[model samples]
Target: MEFDYVIVGGGSAGATLAARLSEDPGLSVCLIEAGGRGDGILVRIPAGAVAMLPGYGKINNWAFHTVPQPGLNGRRGYQPRGRALGGSSAINAMLYVRGQRQDYDGWADLGCEGWDWDSVLPWFRRAEGHEDGADAFHGGDGPLQVSHQKAPRPITRAFIAAGQELQLREREDFNTGDNEGIGLFQVTQFHDPARNGERCSAAAAYLHPVMGQRANLTVLTGARAQRILLEGRRATGVEIRRGRRVQQIRARREVILACGAFGSPQLLQLSGIGRPEDITPHGIEMRHELSGVGRNLQDHLDFILAWKTRDTDNFGIGLRGTGQLLRHLARWRRDGRSMAATPFAEGAAFFRSTPQVDRPDLQLHLVIAMVDDHARRLHLGHGYSCHVCVLRPHSRGQVSLASGDPLADPLIDPAYLSDRRDLDLLIAGARQARRLMLGAPLAPYRDRELHGMHDDMTDAEWERHIRARADTIYHPVGTCRMGVDEGAVVDPQLRVHGLQGLRVVDASVMPTLISGNTNAPTIMIAERAAAMILAAARGEDECAGHQAARAS
Candidate 1:
């Protein structure tokens, strides 16, 4: 099989890019996904995330694990990625955050010319279909729907009130390019009558809508790409395995990698397109030499603080809570509004760890339910939890090959809290979060602290507590970073630095991790990348036309 564009991974970037690129009838695009079609009921309902997040069964999740980290007292952290069409966006809290303006400006400062806030803002707007109508900051006609929470729990409201009572300003919007306040997060969800209260995953917004309508677009689910078929350093196509069959799908124009931060780097190494050290150890011949393929891994190391709340307004596993949830689900099916529409993480805040910081260096999420170990641990009664994470950590890690086998999971080492500065910021952020939870606004619902934490705990005690429990908040980037530097895996246009007929359009291409959730930014990256790819193709066609005219 051959196509003008063969996009690997039917996740956020891949699905969006494939849909956009196939807009022109003349171009044929193929999207290859390793997992099944992600349109199941579990993926559409916002509350279904609780069942899939624990990583007990693979389900629609990759459920990858990181190597034991010294930073967290040698505990192997859980890294759950969505395996189905929408990728992590299908399983995420649906929080729509674009990060701070400085995040993009910082990319520009690092020599990524077209990625500055001014340049990338248009693409962000272009990908969003906001419920609030078109504004200077949001788009109204885009494919991805951004909506306000249909029915936020009272506990969630209390969490926001607590922040305000602690002197944090109430921000109605978090996507103003400067997110330095506390408020409820705008989520990627559908408010339309037909799909109201449903999770607007990337695939649901982009690919699924155009699935059978466009003959030019072909989506192949359950097709795992084994390696890139390279012809003398040029990516021509991909070799994939489906069931018992091994087939090669050729790309006439380009082969784009949208396998995300970890998968993208792993695929490159398996295809012999990485550094010699990463390629040769597994007896694979080097095809291209990019040392930065799997380096520069960054993620938000998160610590959670839970309390046994007396509030029955929050979620829990009790019989009464379960019965209430069933009723909510029934109501959701009728009018598309209830607890079933909750993103679980309803409240959000962005604040600076210190007063002197230029921008917010810490991010917090207040969940309506008690979450311990990414929801892997369960409690009996209703409760609330607060999560605090360092927005930009100084620590760095890498993704390397566990083996030469294409089916094996990559060796992930986030190296969380490796830097002393990261721990310090986290300690500060946790202290502030504790204060917010203990504020007067939440006193009515507040109960015993689950961790036995007190107001008089020293910084040393805080550090010890953090090291014992902190893990990832699921934001990972920079494995295949884009820049103008020699260490960059891709150029400013997202093309592989020293390779032809290939590009990477995903979170892996981020030069640095953003200040907030990464789902919105990942989609925005694909939106900008699609335009660049199409423009380049048009330029090539124009050049050829001129040459033919001259010859004639």
Candidate 2:
């Protein structure tokens, strides 16, 4: 097969780039995805995203488990990467957070030029159409449709009320470059009850809308990229396995890898680009010995504290009983929307764990209603859970190949809370959670029905409970980190460092994780990546260039 560009992974980045590049009608672009087509009901429904977790890897999720982390009591963590068309965004909570200004400035501050917020804000605005309209920090017109919930649950509103009284500062918009907030979240929904029906999936936001119209774009579903076909020193194409047979596709312009963090590094290692010593033992020929190809992994560790509630009220909206589930589903199926997330999470706070930090290091994720573990664990009568995550963890891990075969799962060591400060912040967040519970406003609403955590929550109890049950808040980045630093895999242009005709445009390229959810930022990266690749193909000055991007 031949194309002007061959993109591995029809994920968020791959889908966006394929749609943008093929707009010319002159270039041929092929997008390869490893999972079955995203056709289930849970994927499209915003509230249903949690329900999709279990069924995802069974069909659409890559279902990759991480290597046991010495940091987490030698227990292997479950790292679920989307195998569907929209990638993880298709499976994520769909919170549209762009992170902090410092995150991007840090990229520019450190060798990656053209990556500051000033340069990439246009792309963010270009990809997002915030329902409220344009602002100094937001765009009103873009491919991705970002909207707010029409009818928010009362608990979410109460959460905001609590934040206001606590003096955390309540702002309607978090995307306005300022990090402070206990604001209602603006979700990626279309409208009217906001049941994730019209929410922008990567496929809906980028792929499905532009597929057949562009004859130049060929999207291959369930096609796993085995390796980058490198002819001598340059990447020429990719070898993909479609069903049972291995097929080769050549690229004329570039072979871009948008395989997220896990797949990108795994594919790179399989293609012989990494530490020569590690690659040699896997029976794979060594190419460029980029020692940092699979290092610097990062993730947001969140502690979920769930408590049972008395007097069911609205926290049991979806699960008031089997009776309520039927009623909500009925309304959802008939009208395509419902009063959910409305009165959305009352408030969220970006707080600094330590006084020394310039900005907030911990993000308080508050949910009013009693939802089970992603609704995964059986709902225990009526209960609500709140999630507290350390926004920017200091621990850095790595993603490496355990085997040379692309079919084998990559070795992912997120090194969660490897930094003691992270644990301290989590403990601090627990303290804050207790404070919120004790706040006069929540005293009536929060009965502390579950976990026996109502009265006298102590520091020792918070620390012990937090360490025992803390899990991911779902932001994983920096594996194939983009920078002009030592062994950086890609430059600010998202192009592979020291490699020709190759680029990685996904969460994998983030030098560090942002302060919020990665869904919006990941999409923003794709939008910028598409524009840069298109500019480069047109012989124009692309934002990211090789000569100026070499690691110092």
Measured by TM-score, the strongest candidate is 1
lDDT of 1 by residue, 109-154 (tens): 9999868897777788888889988888898889999999998888
Question: Compared with the true structure, what per-residue lDDT tens digits does model 2 show for residues 40-145?
Answer: 6667766555555554435467767777766666767777677888888677666778888888888888788888877667777777767778776777767777
- Which residue pairs in candidate 1 collide? none
* Cα RMSD, each candidate: 3.9, 3.8
| Residue 370, model 2, lDDT | 61
TM-score of each: 0.97, 0.93
